[model samples]
Target: MPHAEAVALSGHKILAVGTTSEIEALAGPSTRRIDGMGNTLLPGFVESHLHVFSGAYGRKLLQLAPITGRDALHKAVRQFSDANPDEGLLIGQGTPYGILEEDGPITRQKLDEMEPVRPLILMAFDFHTAWANTPALKAAGLFNGRDVGPGNEVVVDQEGLATGELREKNAYLPVLNLRTSGGREMLGMSGDEPETPPSAQERADDIAVLKEGLRYCAAQGITAVHNMDGNRYMMELLREIELEGEMACRVEVPYHFTEGKPLPILEEASRMSADFNSDMLKSGRVKIFVDGVLESGTAYMLDDYANAPGWKGDPIFDTEAFAKAAIEIDRRGLQISVHAIGDGAVRIVLDGYEAAQKANGARDSRHRIEHIEVYHPDDLPRFAELGVIASMQPQHPPGTLGLPLEPGISAIGRARWPYAYAWRDIVDTGTAYCFSSDWPIVAVEPLIGLQATQIRTPWADDMPDQRVSLHEALEGYTWRGAYASFMEDRTGRIRPGMLADLVLLGGDIEAVVPDAFPALGPVLTICDGKITFEA
Candidate 1:
């Protein structure tokens, strides 16, 4: 059997897997063995896409304000400010509208009276929007009539004054920098520096945060994580961690191409790719952000948002430019992962991939489309036709549900709704799919994501029609996740010759009620022949 509860198993890879007595015959006197203690053993989970560092740091930085209503958020900010009198600024992240009572947008004036002296910046649950105080705006030099950046907008009042709400990076970047810089200074003063090289510290912190996130993942039986954020410093930090032998889980780092930039970074990325040792840390592919998110109304929609008419989502790069970049990257023998959320963005990404395929002929580039949330019905089959991997986050649908599904799902209509997660549909078409937490945006628990996949309804919604089978959900987190990161050969499965990464579940998932799977927590997580977590 691939996974067995009782064990006296030992080897670089799985030497023998069976019942305790059956496998004990192969063990020598010095064979190291671990008792499952009645836990259900399974292959270690793999996360297809996640911001490891950001998720880790978010745990320590700000409080998540429940967007129950305007009053609840206002009260939370006021209470937080009151609790930290000496704190320079108030920072809050992950404020989703599903929890809010107000249907309209949130404005900065709501919190003006709470603590105007200190700057405050609160990120929306989507991370695509920001609510900033006047002082914080001024600090970012966003006063007067300055334009934010492309794909971002400043929420202004009828009087043309800033309303404290910013959408996308255009408006959020300025304030985000201020918050990050300020947080860094605060961290520096606390003498809690975890790594070195001033330029590399941010990247190192991300890795440190990711390492901590791994603990949470391990608790859920995740043995491998595919990091999609690409930065020079991040690659270096990964190398440092691997050199020190501190890397417990397998990681595949993909480089992302910056918007409006040439493919020159690909050469540098290739150099880094050379440094990647497939043993533990490996360089898998390159990433590109073709569009924004659907919830924030910046996801580059073909049609306008149903709730907010006359607004089509923004595309980070025009179709021609995006296609050109894809061809160049693909031509260089590098795999590509594009972020396409809206239907329009999805169409654009597919067109680009098709163009790349036509130009370069068929190859095993394994180009993937990240966050394929809204897809044009016509484009669904093309994913499998082109051999593309749909790296999706199951938590998004449940987490962002209840927001007038029109703009995101209704735009595509009922026929496509059945294929939202579309795992069964996509697999039927021969396409590979995977699941991830997209942590920091959502929790990094693979089990939670698996729970969400099995039970598509958000925490508040008790709908049963949206649920999928428990077996399908687990495969998305395991084999599919490994395939998305190109680690299927060594990490996703528990077969012989594969890495000995596995997790011990508190209960047998197959025996649990389908609806009650979320309650099944992980008891132990093993990675690369090492036990990283036990609880």
Candidate 2:
């Protein structure tokens, strides 16, 4: 009974973890007891890559474009418009290519009739493209058919008229601002309070949203998350949360860098990294976009798409510019995560990393290439040789299966298609890799991502050979993701002394049908010796 007398929470940190009886002995007379009921425990799960603010925003916005298809999209958008007639812009998010039934892109003319006066900006499921109406285009100063410049494009017709299809950051930023501003306004308008500019107060509200989202993640057993996008405001919010002792999850925030910007990189990085608290909130790495998505044919490609003839993909930054940035960033002892979906884009990133190494000797910088969807056979070994991590999303291949069907299969062709999710080959060659949901672009559920890895075949009966073992798939989500974020030593595995972040499943993963894993739900989610979520 003396053993039970000991209150075993070793001073706010897990002082000792043992059987209930052993732990009980350490309990003091005033010790509080919590019943475990023989439930399974695990280390908390960590999400390697995600846009936290955007994910929360998406949850608030119109869910017009479900990844399932276009009819659902049209119905959802129409319903939202019908209900919120006073809103200036009819906005929606998440529409993958495979879901659309329309032959061509979603045009402005189609959305014009619904609310011809109000602007409309419906983002593609991938967030790499946008479907804007004429009003939205005009509002964004992209009415005329012209190159909006760098990482942005306006899809045009034969006569050079804006087709309402905007690709990459070019078309996305303007509309993105409109959505952000508009969402804030909506939040203010809903209440009987005076609407002010989105000051620190608004951001505090957003921080509250983030905390709620983190709680949701913890309940699902996520212990850490690699936040792909977080600005100074977000960082401030995080600091506030930490100071208030409200921070419960470990977050690795990556600073974003654009091509032309030079001075801001060091200024921002130094400011952020100088004060970064490694305990729970730390700076992860720097993020850059080298190319767009493969489904949109905007990703830089070595060869032309089978459907879109005379068109190889587009690159956001030229080779020289990319190389220069990579060198400077690498020299600063910061990791780089570049978005490169196509083979050509991947090659360009590789070339940049190689240039950086040549300029400054080989360092332990674990530079990463995000979305290496298509890889040239020759460049497969470069990942391992250069020590680059392939940060990929498995759901893209299975989710975008209908891409070949729409816009003609000629663009992708058969030979190049087999190399989409080449996880086995990448690992065989000694390259490290990780997986993410790219949530809001796709579903945030890790099970869906794992399922895609196990069954590489598209919705149709194609490309079965690309499928990988379930263990390999799970590793990508758990261990590989941790390695990419540089948290391998602290998280990922369910070992003693690690943070008590773990998930309890309704059923064992090994016993369930592989394909049905996507439907599996978490029964409990624990984070940092606290219960975050309980089903």
Candidate 3:
């Protein structure tokens, strides 16, 4: 953490970092020098969790505000369906929590009034719950009310027919899987690979969408991304981008480890890891979902929801099953990152990691919990003890992004506010935590996350020391993220010989005053040896 006044770049590595005079001496006459104009410089942001293709796909769908009332909801749905007349399914994203007039989830019956012929699906921001029209339900072959094991429901009406509201991936994936080249990639479930890969033209479309998404990330100073989705289709799409020389930033896809999939999936994870082990495009990790998100009331919790008595949300994998999978994956040496949002879910995931350590012996396994949204006081120490990485998205906190207070905050109840979004708590307990956007779930801008990280009101009253300084928040988005992804040796620093990945802010980031970080962004972004974006 040296105080650097100037840095000299030699090819793709830093040649010198010192006072302005010392760095100037190393700069050759041919060097291209750009004055900072008083803006701060730092390593490019490393986004720890985002689904590239899914996000690209969401970019195409209609985004509805959670509270868009009944009439407006229908009007927008009809307009989108009419606009895309050729589309078999008129999909929508960013649907609000209480779009319908009544409480509980909006039913498919209501959607049918908007467009009875075309299939309609408006998914929740959390991606766990979705409301569909009758046509969409029939399209997924669940209109007859198909049962999908424990913890997943199709929301049948009193007549025993599907109501078009689906809960959990087990319920909605049936519809998503029907989309061409769309499947369990979002859930990170292994073996849901499409029976037929994307055709040449489809890959062309994928390339078009994904390349644009990558550019958007680069514009925000994102140098590297730890993509949370995995499947052979996405892997192939990224490979095509790298082969065509369209890759502008580093990308890594995980091996989605899901339930009911055999042990053979872990072996495929190893093979995929070895096949695409390059800096630009790679795969050497496994992603799992221990529970759903809190917004949907599916986030497994130790205590029952304040709204629902006698029941706490359940984990996707039973205790013994998770233990087995964690042990196997840990032994394989591939990194493990799980989506655990609730305190109960977090505890189980930690227990599984502890079991893996005991069974496979210890290694530098930087096992991660994707969203430790609500951490139990008791389980707070397990993260440090098991050497877990707390992968969090600051933007997912309540009272931001137009999120209503009910679902995200109230679902956990007022009593747990101190423990929810406990970034300061985890850091104080000596666990390494990294930040991500979880794009398509919230705003993707790291700047927005940084701004959200500063809000400690009410929460400050509960914890008194939950707010983080700007530097610590910046580190969570940089070097610590690199460390979480096992890429610290080459990236995430401005020292000599390290990668030449830097972002120049247009505005003076350090002088922006507290609570004004949301207004800042990069003016120029350089990745590797190339300048990817320039304002």
Candidate 4:
């Protein structure tokens, strides 16, 4: 590729690419000029995986990013709760694992000491772990402890009382369910439709929330998104935006499937794919959670945790159950993405993909594994062999972002240190890869994430080296992501006949230092040949 100068758009497609005058000559009447103003231009970013509705809603809640001290957390909660006394609950986002080291492991007594009367929950940055106050637990019926499925747990004290720490969704659903308005939005669920239909004002408000999220993504140079959480409600919301001609990005929504559901339920997924197929809104994929995360020690590991002997984390699905689900989805010809965060989970998903191939005869299934935080060496090559896409997030912050390595790295055991977050190792294996922010868990800005992937300094001389070049990192966020979703032909690149989804930065990207990427902004954003944003 050469250093290009200009591009001309015809309706929703790129018409020509060349020098400024060469492009201008191809432009016809009624075509508006969008000046670059001496800024860099690139294909608008493809946000690979994120929860759209929840990320937008988190902006209105208590944020605790970059806070570690016990006293700091206490003060933040008090200040937020005091200012918003009318709020139904006090929920905060972005608490890192390091906080446990500073304040000791969080417990019911610890949370009660901070504020016993009010219901409060501090969700971990991973969204896999939560610390609920006594009120929140009691309200959810976990006060005396409830037996949940394989991977879910309600941490309890030695005396058999419930601790404040809640592992996975079922552990803390009660606290999250209390929100009357915009509550379902936070959970990224649309299953429970209201018995009473929403008024026009409420519908408008819901649309506003969706628009706000899409606009935010555009400002960050994102013109396409594979929203990880999905349901008919989410699809309809995006459909409404497309109907109104307000959509500024292409979306690939999925039908989230839970374990133990009958195979017949897949009929709805097929119908969804047929009914909602469009350039703007589409759904034909299925999302599954095969395991939890490493932060809470629930990430389903192949070996026992260094901190806990004879206890490897459990998978949400056992071998036979997952194999059955994979065969059904594969037989339906739908793409699937599994949330496998540990080596054990990763191996099972790989095996399931392999079994699906053996049963149905091989095809370009392109199944995916989200958050390969750690993996076993034997399973590394299977990704390329099985044609699985490794979807990862760069702003995860713990691996090379200077956060304390306690609990996580140590818990994984020194023997498995090399296997944790090995980006270079995975990329070297010829496996397909894509990057995302997983916003509502981390910052959605790609440049900020680029800093960690392209310029992260290892925590120690002995830690594994996993540095990726800036060009490769950008590709992970753009063309590669498009390829993963089968949209490479229409939107990933700036070429003739492709959708005019492009972004203009304020300066030459190649000349800027990787660390300074956070300072860069998308000065102009054009999506589907429409000017959606200008700085």
Candidate 5:
């Protein structure tokens, strides 16, 4: 773990950590040498949070992140539609909330102007909201608002027609299913496997997408991924990929627990945990969504939003139900990871975790709260007290990593700016945490993430600086991330006997300015002692 000139890999574990001369003496003729070229090498990146299947499939969709203004939006949509003429549905990813110059709320009319005929749905960058054209809304039968359960809405106008603004997963899922892949990639978010089995061709297509995603991760120097959304079918697909000897990154999936699912569903989660308890692919965690995101005015906040004064957002689960489920999940010994973005949601989840501890005595649960974008200053210490891991995305903070500031900052209100994405505050409280990209929401590039964390600018002159040190950020994506996922012994650090999951950067990360970190990427990536990528 100390600073060494070189580290040697043998089979699937580190053979030696020493000076270059010392390690060279142990190398056999068959050993392949990798020249660092004055670049830095360290443990491979561990993506602490991401939706791999969705991120993979999203790559096939038209990206709207680069396109701007109404003219560009229409051009991009028209081009994408023309290219995929026969495709059942046209979907766009990374659609900005403020795509239009004058935006009240993005209506179906805006998307209709872009691509009127084909069912078009532009998903917001955060994946919490989406805009669907009239055809898409009709195709999904959401033209007339249907009850989409709690915390989800098919927003309708004064005339009772859908406004095209679909909030949260439940509302937009029907529209998503219109795609050819049957939206199996996101079925896991609702804690459901495909209603019926896929045909052989469909299965093959899904496998191919998974392969693409894994390869993409490998290229980014990600040796391990803690997938935030998935189901049994996804696990099976990953297992098949592993068997085919094509798995480029180690993956850990969770049993998604949605609102309507009964407590007995925890039994199914337990089964999943037992079934896929391997090093390559594992399932020993439960994922739950306590609220939606702030951008869409849906994140359950403690107080009214700055824009919408009367509205405080919605909670996905009833307080008692979530507490009970948390207790049961804890009792069953599954690690719990909840998606909670607002201060209100953060409090509820913290209370639920505390309830679980009271009911089922404490163990090293290492329970995680994904995306603590905003939290009450008083509840800050609970993360450490309850032993919760702050699973966060450095790219998510508004104004960092090219994210816009208005919508997210306004949602939190000016009064709470100090508590929003308070990375430094969380760390100072002695709470364990890790950083991630939350891929497809952003790109799955750790170096970009490192830069975002280090170069984060304060919202106001008086606000506390939230930037973390370069080494601390690196550990978040490596050692600390492994520790969060319970894979510390197997992967995190560069030491003798640790698994040879390593990344060699193109240039020394410390030598460059913070802004230049994004340009520095993996020259070589090795996972399980196999050269997964070499540039």
Candidate 6:
């Protein structure tokens, strides 16, 4: 258990972990042997946060990450439209903020110029904002701005016509509904079940899409995925896959308690917790969004933005409302995971957790704060004090992982630079934290994520170095992630009695440099004693 050179698996569980000779002694004649070929073998990576279902479907959409100017955009749109002639709505994913250099704001007219007739929608990299063409807006009934709820906006012009800039999920849900899949991809984020249940054939298609996503995760050496968004419909699909014995990864779904939903809706979360409690497909967690992302200025900051005067940001729930909901969820014995990006939102989520502890009395809730991108120094220690987990994505930091620095850095301001995506500070405080990709928002590659943490540098020389050691980085993606998801006792370590979830890297992780990590991938991935991926 201290440091083993070999591990033996038998029937979906580790039989022994010891020196090569000791492990070999335990093997029988019928045992299948695998040679690592000097590659490093580790517990399979646990993705702590991601939207698996939608990310799978997003693979088919046109990617705008590589495009820079109008000419390129026009060509890409035209080509995509031509390629998918039967598709009703043309959707583009990973469109960066300020993609159009000459833009005031991304207006419907500008998008119309790119694709005049076919309806088109471009999703921002953060997934917090979207821009639709005039046709798309008209088709979705956003031509005349409709009141999208609190903490969401549909940008409109002086004459009260939609401008195609939609701020949050509610603002864009209508346009997304025009997709060929009927917006089923976003139903988890919207915290709604399908209004009309899918037919038998439709169910089969949905299952296939999820199967592809699971296969993708397996290929990435991901044995466990903590989906940040979900409803019963998604869980049902996963359950079906599990029953069919085709599930490749361990999936943990959460019930998303979106804004405007009644507090009693948490009962559904309890129901899910009871219905699917298997290790492969389980749900006993509730997810909520306290605020949006920093890039869009929807992040609830503690103080006014450096650029925008008197404007901090909007919060999905106030302190009282959030605390009340937290108490009830905690009392029901369910873990809570809230999306809190800005310092203000982080503080609110922390306050709500503390309130839950005070009201329900403390238990091993293992409640988590997702995306603590910006943290207030004053509230840093609460993570350890309240036994909360900091579920973070290393790829989300600006200046690394293809993310632009301006909007996020300027949004947080100079005074708060020391705390923005401050991984080192949080780790030093002895707080429990885990790493993830927040996939589709960022690529779901654990090695890339580990490289980001190892190679990350501060925005300025005056700021503290936020880079973490390789061991810490690995811990964040493996055991720490397993602990965060309540699977530490089952998997996360290549030890005897643990689940047979392991990944054989293409090269020795200890000997490789950070720059070459992207080139190195999983040569073999095993889950539940089955070889899930082999390269």
Local distance difference test scores for all models:
0.69, 0.69, 0.81, 0.82, 0.90, 0.90
Write the number of the candidate with greater TM-score, choosing between 3 and 6. Answer: 6
Per-residue error (Å), model 4, residue 520: 1.1
What TM-score does each of the candidates earn?
A: 0.88, 0.87, 0.95, 0.95, 0.98, 0.98
Q: Please provide, for model 1 over 1-535, each residue's C-alpha lDDT reduced to its tens digit, 9 standing for 90 to 100.
A: 4456354435547665566777777778787666666656778888888766666566665556445676676678788778766665567877764434544656666656655777888876667777888888777776543665566688777777788878775576666555534234122111123245565556555556556766766676778888766455555667787787677677777766767567676786676677775667877577777777766677887777655668876788778988888888888878888878877888888889889998988898788888877676677789888889888887777334233343345444444455455555565676877778777677777777776666555222332254546676777888778777767787677676777888888777777665565566777787887887877
Q: Per-residue alpha-carbon lDDT of model 3 for 386-414, expressed as tens digits?
A: 99999998877776555677667768887
Per-residue lDDT of 249-363 in model 6, one digit per residue for the tens? 9999998897777888789999999998998999999999999888788899989998787999989898888998999999999999999999999999999999999998999
Tens-digit lDDT string for candidate 5 (256-352): 9998888997898999999999888999999999999998988999889988989999899757878999999999999999999999999999999
Evaluation by lDDT, superior candidate among 4 and 5? 5
List candidate 1 segments past 4 Å from native: 1-11, 65-67, 82-88, 98-100, 180-208, 398-421, 457-467
lDDT of 2 by residue, 235-310 (tens): 6677877777677677777777865677345557656766785767887477888888766778778988867778
User: Candidate 6, after superposition: displacement of residue 526 in Å?
Assistant: 0.8
Give one digit per residue, the lDDT tens place, for model 4 in 231-297. Answer: 7766777888999999977888888887656778888888888888888889889888988877688
Cα lDDT, model 6, residue 255: 89
Stretch of 10 with least lDDT, candidate 3: 182-191
Error of 6 at 154 (Å): 0.3
Cα-based RMSD of the predictions, in order?
4.3, 5.2, 2.2, 2.0, 1.2, 1.2
Candidate 2, position 463, lDDT: 54
lDDT, candidate 1, residue 167? 79
